[model samples]
Target: MVFLGGGMPWYAQFGCGGGGCDRIRYMKVVLQRVSQASVDVVNELGDLDPTFDLQQIGPGFLLLVGVTDEDGDDEIAWLAHKILRLRVFEDEQGKMNRSIQDIGGEILSVSQFTLFADVRKGNRPSFVGAGKPEHADIMWIKFNEALRSGGVAVREGRFGAHMRVGLVNDGPVTIVIDTADRH
Candidate 1:
């Protein structure tokens, strides 16, 4: 499924400075899986751009979830169990034998409004009808807790942070799940 990390605004580092300033340092991670998987993370600081940080983590996949008005307790519960149990990685015997729990992998869930960005209208995207913060926050917390209860360590990006994200697609086997589709 699609997951998003809410990041700090790109302008937060500059305070009041306008455009074309030096880029700030931030973390952007993307994971792809099929028979094999690769994760790429860029640390936006230092002279070396697109720095690789995947070596620090273990064998695990990242889940990107989008929050909407229709997402609630049940949706969170279902997704938590499903993602944690998904057997995408192989075990010692060369069998697909590990879940997120078995590998001690954690998840980073971020609140993303741009996931719902409507591009059909014009060059400028429209997010006029996204879920309100009140509803989105409740679901966001519930989803994170549900994943945690399944024995997966979880870390998260800040909510409503303006962030610059970079992703590289290896296998291109991305999955998108809609909470509304469950109902």
Candidate 2:
């Protein structure tokens, strides 16, 4: 995925001004092309659960997504389609020429509000740029659905929960997408 035009876009706008998700209008996502990936939810007692549908994926993407208060359908749509079409997987010629859709890869999406962590002030990271659950949840649902609509299997980590994630990065091919920088 080429930073902006491809891959899943998680939303969270660090306002061009102000504090705490102030709304500059951009979503952030980190996509890691993986040979295998799995995410387990942490139960109320803080135990990791590996039995859900998201137990494991053979070859696919581990999508860490975030969103802001102002993110909407347009951003979601654009990113999903790009993820479905971006050609990063190897083709018959071993060239990075096949898309996830072409290879029938799955997606393990996890809500990652920390993508917006800001440490500009001090040693501690500030999460002021993360969107609130109410709005971000809706965006998360739509983003996953949008990926599923493209004909790939989609799995998810428990939203807003403490969990353990594991993956074997393929090609170590990682991508970072920020809507503000892209479009």
Best lDDT among the predictions, by candidate number: 2
Regions more than 4 Å wrong, model 2: 1-25, 49-54
Model 1: CA > 4 A from native: 1-58, 93-97, 164-173, 180-183
Q: What overall lDDT goes with each candidate model? A: 0.55, 0.84
RMSD of each: 13.6, 7.2
**TM-score of every model versus the real structure:** 0.61, 0.84
Worst 10 residues of 1 by lDDT: 22-31
Question: Could you give candidate 2's per-residue lDDT for residues 100-174 as a string of tens digits?
Answer: 999999999999999988776779997767889998998999999999999999998888888789999999999
lDDT accuracy of residue 120 in candidate 1: 48
> How many steric clashes does model 2 contain?
7
lDDT of 2 at 113: 92
Candidate 1 lDDT? 0.55
Reference-based lDDT, residue 175, model 1: 55
Worst 10 residues of 2 by lDDT: 8-17
Pairs that collide, model 2? 10-28, 10-66, 11-27, 11-66, 11-67, 11-68, 12-67
